[model samples]
Target: MIKGSIQEEDITILNIYAPNIGAPPYIRQLLTTLKGEINKNTIIVGDFNTPLTAMDRSSRQKINKETQALNEALDQMDLTDIYRTFHPKATEYTFFSSAHGTFSKIDHILGYKSTQ
Candidate 1:
């Protein structure tokens, strides 16, 4: 997890990286638990190992229905993807499995809407 604070603000950023498979439900539960523990303005960032669609993937990337479902879970939690804001023109790739020869765009930075 990435943890840091800006200047004098109490807001802190926490980053998480969930496994590629069977991570959506757990992630949603984790988010719910974290939300209960931290202030409303806290920010979360990470490689969720899932995407909203094939469009969210790179030319060499592949995604499944489970991955799409995970993305939907994030949306249900009201998390805002910040990578698009920071690097609109750049493609973010977080995982590369040399053994499988598969490259996926699972990395991301999601923030709580209340922070902005």
Candidate 2:
């Protein structure tokens, strides 16, 4: 996690790193932790490992619990997943799978709704 301020505005930035295997509760936990400390500004960007929605991942499976948790945390924080927010119909991926020949957007940039 990293923090900074410009003029009177404070911003917290985080680069998440989720585990490859198992449920990544840590991602949601981090969001919760940061939400607790927030005054107004925050920027969370990283490899979430799990997609919060079906569109985020190339898989046809149901939405994962940890992903829902992260989504809930983001809502509580009044943070918007900027990538998804602006590019509603655009499908892009930050990570690619060689074996599956698929691309998944596991990385994200989340921030307060008021920010760009």
Give the whole-model CA lDDT for all candidates, comma-separated: 0.64, 0.73
lDDT of 1: 0.64
Instruction: Please list all clashing residue pairs in model 1, or write none if there are none.
Output: none
Residue 19 in candidate 2, Cα distance off native in Å: 1.5
**What is the Å distance of residue 57 in model 1 from its true position?**
2.6
Candidate 1, superposed: residue stretches over 4 Å from native: 1-5, 38-40, 59-63, 114-116
Clash pairs for candidate 2: none
lDDT of 1 by residue, 23-56 (tens): 6666776776776554545677777766544545
Candidate 2: stretches off by over 4 Å? 114-116
Ten-residue segment with the worst summed lDDT in candidate 1?
52-61
**Candidate 2 C-alpha lDDT tens digits along 2-72:** 78887978777778788876435787676666667654576778877776677876664677776777678
